[model samples]
Target: MTTAATSTTAAAAVPFRFFDVHVVRTRLLGRSMVRITFGGAGLTDFASGGRDQRFKLFLPHPGQDAPVVPTEAGEDWFPQWRALDPATRGIMRSYTVRAQRRTDGGAEVDVDFALHGADATGHTSSGPAARWAARAGAGDRAVLLGPVEPDNAGVDFRPPAGTDWVLLTGDETALPAVAGILEALPDGTDARVWIEVPHPEDIQQLDTGAQAEITWLVRDGADGPRTGLIPDAVRAARLPDGTGYAWIAGEAGTVRALRRHLVGDRGFDRKAITFTGYWRKGATEEQLVEEALSGTGPADD
Candidate 1:
């Protein structure tokens, strides 16, 4: 076995707080990805933990003008928000921080949204989060609950001390996170990445100096089940030799399948892999959260 790198360091710490931000602009990153740029006064204290850092976005429902931000006095924000009428309480969604930077005005963060088409019934129906991103414009405000300091436990990408190589696999929903992880890796770090998207145009240029070999699998109108493409591609590829760390995410079922393949068939140590179900095929994020709270969510180890 190849020896692991001995000089890797942990990410810097950051604080966690809530902020109210407004959309500065929106742009199409690819055929199925929309990049929304947000900025506001609250972002003055905003800090990001680089790789796979997640934040909660409170989006307004239709007919509501803006998201209703809860108080930060205590940890009752969730209960307080839930106490409000369902129609007016706004929806909460989780997303990865694609990029963050400080400007002359304040700070700005980019959030990439994956656009999905209509359901099996052919009715034009998308989830609330996707719908909000699709119609969001400049000046539209949303409440962001994220880190205000640099030393919190919000980030999820934790590579072990002896990790010499990396394997990253995911679908469109995990693209931003995967990109962030790749960019955070040191130069000369060996990594193999596999990302599955709905369209060939979804492949965007990644800015990273790491020694990475990326394979983008475009599932354009595949006849059979679509979820298997990512795992199939991962199963076919040959992994590099080393004490490797693998990060996998995307649809819940596929994530589990890929984890089994890595641990069972490929002989990767279960402790060496970090997997998360970003979303389930038919279930909503709300349901997934409920499952997690009940201690039944997909395992990350």
Candidate 2:
């Protein structure tokens, strides 16, 4: 009964539909990240809203060739999927769209996965999605709850009109979205970016027309404790003058602190900042899903 109510609420969300996709290829970005490309006839209608576009991805369990999603429920698929036995049901996760391109065969979408835990091989400490991403290959099947229209609600990196500058910060888990946002910034847009990664190799070359200065914070080579590096860096920097919009994501606690710092200490209006907690430290995605179900809630974008 509770699941039915939850599903009804979630199902009413607009402009998203399920599409079946299969992996076309994979690339190792670094020791801690991998990029997977998915394509099929179904992706012909997959329209990405670009910058920070997010979607739900479902993967199969061990020994299963395809994810066991109850798409037959149609628009109310969420409830049916929720009722499946955990061990037999599909593994659902959220991800950001890095890019969408056309090839001779069809349209393909690129998604970058941050490999956490022991190392980039993604063999240790990774949940289902990371492990699947690390080992995924051409022909691997999955399902995506993606947008059909270019202008959809799945994207969240909106800087309101007349913003003079922008500040963006995140850890590796939020890097893909940050890259997309930077790529979409207008020419000469003053932008400041901060990114934290476990290793230096995880740093990416971001190309953007915006007048962007990006600072990469590497945990492995830091002088002091790896903790609070981003907050410390932001505190010591001189921000550009004028109206600024901020987007901060990653560990929930850090995100809250940064948001508080921006609003309380930096004197920025709360309305000028967009904050999302991609993940909470020490909490599994499953736990997060449960929280959402129970209305404790954070449905990250």
Candidate 3:
């Protein structure tokens, strides 16, 4: 591993590529959230654009010790990785760059995982990514496909210029990105945020300099079904006036409902609201990707 601190200057102008990284540490941020920090020699070239920055993490499959580092570069990497035998391919998942920092040891990136709930039998069952996070330890390796340039234009958080206020809404899966966006907002900027989580203990203390009004909604024990909680909360909240941008992400159905409420009921411009479905109720990420390839999945944006 590299012991030098990451450079603060601009990153080299390079295309996005795969970086082999190892777990530096893991910690519990909340009842259902585990933060895993990754660092390695390849992180020296890792550049983060902050707000809602996303990357593909290739995690080791069951019984495997580490992810197979793909040899192809740029656009060829995905095709090569896809062509591998299913039994040998690593589990690929999308995640947000919660934050990145330069430490005395090297550059480190944080990715937070939301632990899934248990079945009716009361036994805990999590997805592959969450299970990996739960058991991951120092020195465990994975592969990250992300931007090598600091200001990579692929980042999704593009609030229009002259935005007087901001509205942010999402579920547990989007917490990291929402937190990163809040922290990156200009100090004293007006913002409203609503985050829904599985448990009340999942509410975390977000460090943001923005003038943010935050509301946390607990869903696991809420009255009625959990499906409509997010949209209900959004429907009841008072929106701010003036030209503003709204960033909404969560389950596909809920995200669509919120977007419709903003555009149809609230009279906000469709172009001004940015929405994404982080996941669906029963659909896995792989399934969603397959559906997207076939033009059957929910709109990514």
Cα RMSD (Å) per model? 5.6, 4.6, 6.2
Residue-wise lDDT of candidate 3 within 249-296, one digit each (tens)?
A: 877777888888988888877777877777776666567655654557
**Which of the two candidates, 1 or 3, achieves a greater TM-score against the reference?**
1
| Model 1: per-residue Cα lDDT over 80-123, one tens digit each | 88777766786877888899998888889999888675222433
Per-model TM-score, in order, reads 0.89, 0.91, 0.88
RMSD of 3: 6.2
Give each model's whole-structure lDDT: 0.77, 0.81, 0.76
Model 1 earns a TM-score of: 0.89
Ranking by TM-score: 2, 1, 3
Query: Which residue pairs in model 2 clash with each other?
Result: none
lDDT by residue for model 2 over 166-193, one digit each (tens)? Answer: 9999888889999999999999999999
Whole-model lDDT, candidate 2?
Answer: 0.81
lDDT at 245 for candidate 1?
Answer: 92
Question: Which 10-residue window in model 1 sums to the lowest lDDT?
Answer: 1-10
- True lDDT of residue 37, candidate 1: 97
Question: What ranges in model 3 sit over 4 Å off?
Answer: 1-14, 118-124, 222-226, 299-301
Q: Cα deviation in Å at residue 1, candidate 1?
A: 36
